[model samples]
Target chain A: MAFVLELNGLTKHYGNIQALRQVSLEIPQGTVYGILGPNGSGKTTMLGLIMNILQPTGGSIRLFGEAPRADHRQKIGTLLETPNFYHYMNAVQNLQIAAAIKGVTNPDIDGVLEKVNLLQRKNSAFQTYSLGMKQRLAIASCLLGDPQVMVFDEPTNGLDPVGIAEIRDLIRRLAADGKTIIMASHLLDEVEKVCSHVAILKKGVLIAAGHVDEILAQDDLVEVSAANTPQLPELLKALPHCKQITAGDAGKWLLHFEQGTADLRSVNEYSFQQGIVLDHLLLKRRSLESKFIELTN
Target chain B: MNLNIPHLLRIEWMKVKNYKAFWILMILFVVSMIGINYIYWYVKQQFVASGDIAAQAAGSMIFGDFRFPAVFKTVSQMSSWLLYFPGFIVIFHTTNEFTFRTHRQNIIDGLMRKQFVVAKLAGAFLLALVCTLLILLTSLVFGLISGDGYFSLEGLQYIGFFFVQSCVYILFAFTLALLVRRAALAVGIFFIYGLIFDYLLAVWISRGTETTLGYYLMPLQVADELNPPLAELKKVIGSTNQWIALGISIAWLAFYCFFPIRKFEREDL
Candidate 1:
């Protein structure tokens, strides 16, 4: 994949507090990349550095093969934090200011407003709108000029379920249109569902980075339940495929399989020959949440 | 969006329009200046009507001329406004950013720090220009009753002084706001700078100090001191004083224009 943004050994410090330390990552074009970290873990700091909103004390970042500058900023759209519109101005006016700053002229400000479903509220003052509408307004601002790269920091923050869903759909639709997105979020589920690639940070250090599925994949665990599972745990101890056996709740027995060992027909047959009746058997997989905890922990 | 400078300026102007309080204050300031001039003109008119030479000289001291040529005096009065108002308004600008928390968003919304700074300075300058013109027109009305001529070289110089002072306002207000990063604090400090601190320092120096520092401070020396036509007044104060004040103001303008721009651009907004 071609890298659209690359940062190398990035570091930042305020007084004695280090906000970012040696953060190096490459975001490829057209990928929904997620930066995951807890509060004060430097997620916002890193995004600020990448977007050229903050100067890094050390290291450098390149956007589209050039260092980020005022000219290069036109190519990127951003929705950082809450929608910050002039409280007195209507949605259209707010977007007008945004478009001007980006050097775009006479845009169908109404058109972009319509996409965020804010067409009706385009004439209303931003302070009059609900929090969800405010967020949508922020997204609408980001949509101006159809920028190639988009960065949203905690886009769903302080939104209700419906708002979150709307923003999620919007993000997904934008990604589907071949737009590159770098979303930094503390919400694990949001990142898990929308992101193609993920990077998890703790404190100021990147602890994990890779594709979601690969990062979350688990070694197989086959759960076997029988009428006499209490005895089955003892019976499973002899099998070479069984790395370990544990008694599970509901009278089930868990058989941990060795990595690269998938053939379980022989073990099942042996259980059958031993007069062990299998009520149900299934493989257990790790969820993203579980993997996230494991990785960060 | 292609960033259009004119479009941004227009948008900024629209935002300024929404500030009813600021415009109200502007009107109040101009009206007060006009009222003072009117009162002075009325007294002078009585003396001239009486045909008393001694009274006429005394009346000129009190009322001054109230005609278009008197725009010179109006310019002088308005020039000080240009110098001081921005420092006050700048607190509004800086604090509005903090109160509204828009500075962070402005950074995030793809606005370069340099652009934001320029837009503010330009906006403040534009506001100052409007205020200067309004006072000038008010003075012209006062001059109409006095039957004075309109638009002289001195009057143009008054305009120049007001314009330059407006630029100084832009520099001082913006720089102080950026440095303080808080509206109320910056404004309060500016109030002290304008009202109390500069005067106190000037009095302290003029009384006994050998430093002659009071003459160097623009805010201290310009208090009710007028400009342009005030060359005579300034001369009474000493040519060195004017030069020193100009030098200090320029130094401050340079700091605001460059230093804060660099600092804020590098800072994490």
Candidate 2:
């Protein structure tokens, strides 16, 4: 697969603080790649380094198969941290500045603003914009130059639920149009919903990185409850697909099966053949949120 | 780094185009320049009308034999007091980029760090150019209205020197904004340094050297000397002092340009 971005041993130090430590990952083209971490887990610092806003103490970054350069940056749109704009200028004026910087002579500023639903207020001063409007304007600014890659740091931050959903839909549409999106977000559910691939970071270290399904698809959990819960663990232990079984609350036992091996019928049949009756046998698919908590903690 | 001048200038223009404060400050500077020059002309006329010998002598020094070149010198000098207004404008312009975090956003928008510095410098140059042009236009109109014949235009080099002087002050303000990175703090330091610190330092150094050359060579002083107060005061600085002042001013300009670029190149934001 062609990689849109690649990092090798990327490290950053802010005086005594090591913001990023030897982080290395590759983002494949046309994938919604997410850099997930809690606040101050170096998500913003990493994005700043890659965008050349902050100097990396150590590392190399390659975009589009070459070293990062000014021209390379032109092909990538970015919104880091907050919507930074001239408060005295209106939305259209602010986007025009971005268009000029990006070297787009006939920039469809209105099209992008309409996409973000800020076209109506394009002439209003930025200071007069609400928080949501400011955020939408930031997104609109990033859509200039028809860039192939979009880098957003907490894109949906400070938005109402409706605004968040609208932005999420916009991101999905962009990705559908074959744009490679690299977003840094602390919202686990948002990342899980929108990102096709994820890299989880904890304390400046990469804890997990892979396809979302693969990373969250380690095993299917089966919660089986019976009248004799004490005897359930012994029965589950005999099954080859059941890797582990642990007691749960109120005469319930949880069974872990290897990926793609667990099925309700199989577990039921095994219990029936063992002459043990089963009351509850539900397959619990692992969620990204739970996996994230498991890895980060 | 490939530096595209037009592209950089366009970027800078986009920043200031819709900025109300920028226009307000510019209008204030222009209005103050015109208002103060008119007041100075009226006072000079009153001096000429007075019958006292000292008042007549002072009046003649300024207005009695006013040639077009002397008009240029008088008008440009009268306008120089308002340089701090443009200086404040430059300061606010530079600091606004940082205050709004647009400096960082601009980089993310694909501007190289060097380009950001170059664009700001270009903006400063443009402001200085506008100020110089206003001085030229004002002086030309005033000179034509107040004096006779194009023969008064003989000392037009003073106007060119005025342009250079405006650039020096604007770049000095730009350098301060780059170094301080805070609008109020940079403006404060600029005023204190230009009004108090440089004056005291010049006086202290001149006292020790027993020569006023030391005073004239200070950064602001050298630029101020470029368009001396009166036509006769031009002779106070010999040809050698003029050359020294020109050399020092150029050196200061070079520092103001390069030092900020170097510092900005290494800065994280």
Candidate 3:
């Protein structure tokens, strides 16, 4: 896969504390890569380093096959932290300045402002903006010059639920438009919903890194809930596809499948053949939060 | 390399234009400088027409007190005022970078740190020049209207001195703000240094047995000696003290520009 950004043995330190520890990551082109970690996990530091806002103590970064080119700066639109803009300038003026700096002419600042649902507030000073509006404005600034790479650090750091949903949809839309997005956030649920791949950092170390679906694809277990819990456990135990059946809380039975022991076909067949009724039958999918907890520890 | 200096200049210009405080302060400086010149002119016209020796001496006193030199030989009079508002304006121009965190965005937007610094310096230099010229022209026009006949070659020389002095003062102010990095602290120091420190220290030193001690403490002594607005100061104090003042101003400028740029280059955004 073509990588839009690549870090080679990237490490950084603040005083005696290490912020990043040889944590190299490749953000593939046209992929939304979520960087997941707790606070002080080098997430913001990594974004800072990428934008050349913070220099790495040791290591190097390449953006779109170049080493810190002005052209690369034009390619990447970064919201490295809570958006810091001239509070007196309105949204249009703010984006216009950004566009001018990037050498983009006649930029559709208004269009991007509209995309972020900030068109109506385009003339409002940033100081007068609500937190959500500020966030939208920041995102709008990033969309200037039609940059292919987007990097946001805690983009939803202080957004309401509706604001969060708006940002989530915006990120999804950006990805759908084939924009490569590299975002660092502590919001696992948000990342899980939008990110195709992720890297989880804990205390300056990358604890986990892979595709979201593949990372959560662990042991497959089926959850079966019924009124007659005892009879359900017994019924699951006798099934050929069931490797091991265990009883769970609230009249639930967990049937573990060893090496593709249970398929949807056999699951349906066995349930129909046994004449057993199940109140609920759902696939036991691994949640991102659980996976995150497992990795961070 | 054609590195798009014009574009960077445009960006800086837009910032200057949008900054309401900058425009308001500049306008205030222009209007006040002109208004004071007009007041001096009116007073001068009354004395010259009345043919009263006492009143003429009073006119001289007015010139002495206000220090609005009837004829410009160099920028000494203008330099004194330059030290006041234009320096503060220059400081504000650069200090806004730190206060607003716009410098970080400027970097992220693809302007090299070197280019950004150059743009700021250039912007400050141009603004100082324009503001000083405005004062010089307004004063010359007012002086001419009052029949002072001060708009001569000597007057042009004084205006030139004013321009150079303003630039130097801006450099001094720019460096201070850059080194300090806080709006209130930088601006406060600028005012105290320009308006208060020189006056208090000059008086305190001049009161002593050595009358020449004021030369060291007075801002004009340093400014006049370095810029040499009039040829008279060198005849009076010799070039040695002038060289010393110039050296001090240069050192201050170095500390202001280099120290802050170095610190900012290493600082995390």
Instruction: Compare the candidates by DockQ and give the number of the best one.
Output: 2
Q: Which candidate model has the greater lDDT, 2 or 3?
A: 2
TM-score (C-alpha) between model 3 and the true structure: 0.82
Identify the superior model by lDDT, candidate 1 or candidate 2. 2
Each model's TM-score, in the order given? 0.85, 0.92, 0.82
What is candidate 2's CA lDDT for residue A283? 86
| Ranking of models by lDDT | 2, 3, 1
lDDT (tens digit, per residue) of candidate 2 on A173-265 = 999999999999989888878999999888888878999877655677888887755776876798877888877667788788887788888
TM-score, chain B, each candidate: 0.77, 0.91, 0.75
* Ranked candidates, highest TM-score first: 2, 1, 3
Greater-TM-score candidate between 1 and 3? 1
Report how far residue B186 has shifted in candidate 3, in Å: 2.0
Task: List the lowest-lDDT window of 10 residues for candidate 1 chain A.
Answer: A257-266
Report per-candidate DockQ: 0.51, 0.80, 0.53
Grade the docking of candidate 1.
medium
Ranking by DockQ: 2, 3, 1
Query: In terms of lDDT, which candidate is strongest?
Result: 2
